[model samples]
Target: LEWAGDEFPWVLEHHSNLEPETQTWHSKLVTENWDSPIIFTSMVQFLEVLFGGGSRGARRMHNIANSVLIFDEIQSLPVNCVHLFCNAIQFFVDHARSTTLLCTATQPLLDNLKFPDKGQLTLPDDRELVGNMTEVFEQFKRVEIKNLVRPKGWSEQKLIELMITQLKEKGNCLVIVNTKKWAKKLYDRCINSVDADSLFHLSTSLCPVHRKEVFNTVRQRLDDELPVLCISTQLIEAGVDVDFNSVIRFLAGLDSIAQAAGRCNRNGNLDMAQVYVVNPQDEAIDMLPDIKEGREKALRIFSEKDETELLDPEVMSLYFSYYFYERANLMSYPLTEKQAGRKDSLLSLLSDNHLNIGIEKNAIKLQQSFKTAGKAFKAIDSPTQAVIVPYGDKGKEIIAGLCADFEPAKAFKLLKEAQKYSVNVFPNVWRKLIDAEAVKPVQKGEGIYFLEERFYSENFGLSTEVVSKMDTKIS
Candidate 1:
């Protein structure tokens, strides 16, 4: 506050492929230098800066010192990077003189973070800002979660009936499923049954701008006490402001369940809200190992604890303890593909370079592979590609601009705007689109791909099914 003399957050940052203007702005305000009092960044950017490389950390070292680092929804941090992340934070506090604040309703067992050399990270005993967290969580409770996981899961028809009933009773309802395919299926099944105006869908398949439009419509419907139903993936689980009187969440970790509940009674307009955890028949989560493992862990807690104690801060701590303990072997990002079965991780490469057992190096610094470590680690740890979709007028306009004669300044600005209209797809889905000639590069070898307008849907989003020239295919 004292340094910038600005009351608002001017440095909104996510360090990745950026426009030239924004890049200049980042340096102009020393945002990369971490001089701003308040700046919002993605987990990817944060992890990249922390573990990406030595040069990045070195550049921001003095600036980040004494700054308060707040990690919202800390539970969403990747399990593979837990120990590495914990050690990095421990180093920041002990040696770099920075304060780290982990904020989440579902508090993880990060306090028990263990390092190999250092037995345990000694977190601060007291947080002056947040005293008596248990009472705080209890006092702030707004939703009551009910478990409805049955031996035979709810059928598609039964799930729709429940959603309709909830919408009629609660005025607005939100159903969050495990995957996009399921979300699309639910949206399609209810399209003819429910009024078009009252039904909505939200997922990463829709561009950010399209999703924002849906968010606005959903928020307005909730505010007006209208009977609205939304089918969505886990995209609305956190960082979304819309509130629903009732919500249906597919079973997952307690942390994820808590995040799902956050979307209900967000501002506490209702006296109390209901969150139903359901298991759907034929629900596919095999590809989503995180959600699959999380559901298994949550089931264990359900057997051991009462429903009322499920959302308790202590219970959350317990869930994370079980979660971390089970995945202790994977806390370090293991080098899998080429170096599998060697017990090598990015942490080892960054730390002691146990790979170099008896070798001695001079001033060349071959002991650590900072570049290799950065290259090996991905924040989400998924191989995904971005495709610019033509969702609406803005999306079309941006695409047109990018397709025009590639003027340097104009193209840079248009490329920045493309981010709002882009959708990320997995490699297989991308290949499907490419094979169908549904997407083409914005430039020859720039790696930026644009989706055909025919492939994008007004009701859902990107369709990955095989398509004939005359028809659109969605599966």
Candidate 2:
């Protein structure tokens, strides 16, 4: 549903999960090559084409030249890939001639970003759209962020109770948790207090199509001023449109806190909205060091007794200064040398090999490790494989199509359609499902998988709980 009545020509730069050919000209693009005159794309897609070594993404790299690139939340840039991201951006601007724009309430100090290698986001003084950000930020004030994060973190019951309390003052409430497991746990508790119809659970466990369905229902319910409660992971923080009178966000980065505020009082019907920062006791972010560090910085801001607003531009600057200084060594995409048994990084391999360990005058091949760096690079730490879930009759039909005899054209169309019902599972979870025979590939060597119907939940969407419980039963 796009309306460009008298505006410029527009097309979304995306692969699967697109509309049919008849819907718009965007779908007719050949293999998502990103050749549109006016293109809208995700940050991940831009980064992939910028740094990724894949031929598919490289084919679209030239399209970014002489075009505009907007990074909605520039602060959300990965800590380790800071230098890689900046250096690539410099290349695009200086070499390819592209215009870059950043739109973030909590902009990170990219200029101060320094590593051993020379990859810094150095910008001129006249680059700022607004000279005085602190004053400008005050004008956009819509939500009051309240720091209620305790030392030991809020218990599951305490968070639910807080939501119940907010319901009295506000009609709709949103609880953003850190992990999907915690979201599901809190959602189960929320259903007991609110009606099952009004309670919604959102996470990566559900496919994009399923999430869209939930979004439509939630938005409609909010419009009617009906009592609505949604427990979601950080996925709903950005780019989601639905709003609530009160928002309870799990304590995270300052940028994340700013983003959560956008979901509250969005239309500004209320005088002022409130966003509560709550830390869950059961939350564990060991694999997520970036989030852990961001949470610690946010805790520092919480300890301040000043009357400054949560998204005060000055406060945001302090948070990033602390965060970047703490993670100074990781800005260069750190990696280890496989052969040299020494500390190295992906950026160094791609750059002018300053710490050359394996270079000899008579070397047969170059030790730049260009291919190694490309193969090693990953946008997301946890690489997930999409699994088709039985979300509805449409999902079932897509699964049937995937299992049918091989035909490239037909398979491509079916795969595109299946994107709606596909849930991306991490490697560990995928392995567990495979071990329990809860999932299997639809076509061998094709890499497309289908999950057993019992493993997919109407409430939880997808989980390994059924497989684990069945194993215990067998034992």
Candidate 3:
């Protein structure tokens, strides 16, 4: 029940019209069987259960014990909670008897930091596991990073003007900006200036299924060599695999820049494509260390010479070297047992052998977690109803196969297994839901989606605070 767009059965059940039996069974399977086995949820879901509030959340709370948990985009965890989050994770893996997997293309430098030696779990060396990611990145080099440095300022107009040329020539391009507002602004400009069908708006505004639909459509166009233009926030920076002939990135961190580069000519078909690093007016992205540190690191390295030379990996390595060095510091913190907070941290919640000692107490704790989950779910975009888009013959067959040994928690897994047939909300849609807020328009703007502040508050589950403290550094 910690449901979101990417979790399909939940989405199907939440957004699609479904039979009563299917819906009842889905609820029972998720709520009653807390220890059913594998659970597929997002980083936000897991974090909310641990630190925030809901009812279905508590139902699945105790189940964290004695299972393997995987967190996608672990780096996206809020910065302030990194220590607490990682420590809790360490407790779960070592003491609570659960194993965890941090899945992402760009691994956050979590395991490298210091924590209690007693509770530490072994994580693979991401650098080695990825084995010279830079080398692999070179082979996949479909892009060349271009610097668009102009003291006059880079306007949305200028960005779209250049992108229009790329779209007409190559028929596909992706533009990534630091925020949703900028993405919307650019997306509107493109649509108004060019063929609307050829231009696509992608953001966290749409649900996951909606985003997935858009992504699939875009992918098909790329495959068919049809004209397509997409404007999006940095959410699509990692994991998403579609590539374009060119990518124009608003100036941000080096890691973000590298992530933007990863999206271009990723199939290695074409020679190097172009990735323009341009500075956009009216926003400072380098507000956080992750944002500021990399760009600043790149700037410091290039201060004695030309900025354009910094795009080469040999030169860019300095950016990451300095960037990770600072990131490592952010990861460093001392943890005492008292700071562990949860009583479960002291007593293993998973062990059946210890069950006799605090059975009632644990029940109460689980109930609390569920209550919190319910509260939190309401704040974020929770599924109000399930959606049932008719599946083609292949999709029906795939769904039939999953129904054979179906577990409700495996809804997303089954949907993913059936990717050949169906489409759920892609990840970016949820990102938009989580990021964009409904606010009244302060200025007259075309193609702009105005949102109310209450909607923004609700979209973030009314939990996370809006952060505007971006780094003011130039270059």
Question: Which ranges in model 2 have alpha carbons more than 4 Å from their true place?
Answer: 1-42, 52-54, 115-117, 124-132, 305-307, 337-341, 359-367, 465-475
| Candidate 2: residue pairs that collide | none
Estimate TM-scores for all models.
0.85, 0.86, 0.60
Model 1 score (lDDT) = 0.75
lDDT of 2 by residue, 88-128 (tens): 88887888888888777677887776453468766888878
Please list all clashing residue pairs in model 1, or write none if there are none. Answer: none
Q: Return the lDDT, model 2, position 44.
A: 61
Arranged by lDDT with the best first, the candidates are: 1, 2, 3
lDDT of 1 by residue, 15-74 (tens): 332222123332223224444466566666677667764454455546656778888888
Error of 2 at 68 (Å): 2.8
Model 3 CA lDDT for position 278 = 80
Of the pair 1 and 2, which is ahead by TM-score? 2
Report lDDT per candidate.
0.75, 0.75, 0.53
How well does candidate 2 score on lDDT at residue 389?
88
